[model samples]
Target: MALFKTSNPALGTKTFQDAAARYGGAIDVANRMTLNGTVNRTGILLICAFATAAYTWRAFMQTHDPADVSGLLMLGVFGGFITAMVTIFKQSWAPITAPIYALLEGLFLGGISALLELRYPGIAIQAVGLTFGTLLTMLVLYSSGLIKVTNKLRIGIIAATGGIALFYLMEIILGFFHINFVSINGSGVIGIAFSLFVCAIAALNLVLDFDFIEQGVNAGAPKFMEWYGAFGIMVTLVWLYLEILRLLSKMRSRN
Candidate 1:
């Protein structure tokens, strides 16, 4: 189960070649930027970001009780996040539904941040700063070509992510039964170590997202794809941010 790096409908074949030929390259096989290419879709990414941030702020501001807000925020956050993935899996509705995903996720995050801040004081800001730093660092490494996004790597990421998701699902089930085998971050040194490892995997996924965008542009995917592309990037970023937040919270608890 690879992480699915490229959405090449062509599957690397002659059909893709014929389609590219007949359609004058609806999916640009060559890497070149057109005025209306995927690069343009970046605006959609910004739009999504603004929408998310605004809603999140609204959710936070509306909350009067810290613990109550945190609990609801967590529910909404997980709901929105899980919903986005399910929506994307539907494929046909990705464009329309993905934006809604962004909006909901924003509200979820904003409320969660407010809750965390109320309880932990400055954890929210610290997490944001740390998340940004990791993102920037990953970007620099990617732009310099120090890290390559190979098909194998993508597959590995997808597989690991699936494993992690499975563990999380189990944790959720056990939590309901009042059975606590796994810590929120994992238990003891091993749990903490596993959290760090998972965090690294999440960070590496960012690298894959960057590669996918570059590949899409080079292939000359449709201009509309830019929005799709940006949306994809946002998905990865949001995931990364949440994981970072969780990791930080666990560390704080330890201290």
Candidate 2:
């Protein structure tokens, strides 16, 4: 099996390779991954995420106080992070861990979105609309072969994603010292442009993710990999939505 680098860590070439090797030479028919199965599983995970998000959204709507939901926000952020790490390393556990991760992220997104919505108004819905619209457009393009996932394309996207990740890691480390990357986070022209670039990159990552999942299915990966693949797609969707929300917020802040 040939492996390719992808911006999304969950659907990397090594993931399929490792899964194939672990399952031995003969692929199990009853346990083989299918595209339809992955789609259904992804739907389930999205529902799980939205359910928790609605829960948090309702709570925040009632109190309208950031302080009231601070604890829930923290739990969602840290808990989601921990669960994501576990699922990444233990891919086989995705069936169990993916929903947990989704549920936790919903809490975080809902709380933060509620807070931000109070400031900007209507931004959250706009972000969600754009995110899903972008996803649909990209899916159509990929399906139509208008956007080919070539080796060069994958390599470029993967490299750019790594650089962005490093930049964010540095930003987080610098924050402890009260330093900030205003150039990238502010509402100035440069900041807006930066967010646009990041959002575009994130949207492109979905294409790579789609390719990765298709390849995994063709590779006859284990049935459990359907859940793992869905988890990977959800990760990208979450990142894409957050970036869209951030971009919208920055644009709104300037107004």
Candidate 3:
């Protein structure tokens, strides 16, 4: 059985195992995944995301019209979803599709962040700082062996992540029927607590992503898997940032 297991759908339990099996004996030393390479690819993807995000952010600021970037936002929403699905199913294509996914997500995030920033000035920067701070803290803990990815912790995080995902999906589905979760979505105590819980879970996911990527490297996954690993980290980071943004917005609304 594969020892690697992560709550991240992008980096499933079998991800490294399957990649190793397929590329076994075919990967040269230079073509094997490396921690440094994955980090570099992750940096590249972040830059790609930031570039387009800046474009949309500036557009919104200049026009002060959501309509101007509405099309791009929708495109990012749906296109990023499709691209992520493709990358998840076809891991080998991650080297190509991952950057595309980042760019699309940037469009969506930029528009949303700008809209929120307009309403709650400085919230975006606060959220960004918290998001990256949590990421760095988690990285330090994980690297120091202070937070071990034991089976129990792994399973707990996975279960919590799944529950959160299901709740969000239900919320979306109910929206079409005109049913809304006012209390949970409002700026009330319940909403704030829920957001805090979600933010914690999202932060824990970064640890799982790190462990999964390390396992991939140890398994000698193909060099392209470096991109895949970085892609997985990006997915977690996006989720973390969005959750932090929501949490900050909720708190700001109370004041």
- In angstroms, the error of model 1 at 37 is 6.1
Higher-scoring candidate on TM-score, 1 or 3: 3
Q: Model 2 residue 15 lDDT?
A: 85
By descending TM-score, how would the candidates be arranged? Answer: 3, 2, 1
Give the per-residue lDDT digits (tens) of candidate 3, residues 111-176. 999999999999989988898899899999999999999989999999898889889899999999
Name every residue pair that clashes in candidate 3.
Answer: none
Give the per-residue lDDT of model 2 (tens digit) for 90-155. Answer: 988999999999999999988988888999999989988998999999999999999999989888
Which tens-of-lDDT digit does each residue in 1-255 have in candidate 1? 122423221111122222224443543434333334444454454466556655655656675556545654565577666766665454334457666666666666777676666667788788778777888899899999898877687677767876787787888998889887664455467666777877788788778767766655555544444455556666766777777777777777776
- Alpha carbon deviation, residue 221, candidate 1 (Å): 1.5
Candidate 1 regions with alpha-carbon error over 4 angstroms: 1-47, 50-63, 66-95, 182-187
Among all candidates shown, the one with the greatest lDDT: 3
lDDT of each: 0.62, 0.88, 0.90
Question: Candidate 2 at residue 41, lDDT?
Answer: 95
lDDT of 2: 0.88
Ranking by lDDT: 3, 2, 1
Which 10-residue window of candidate 2 scores lowest in summed lDDT? 1-10
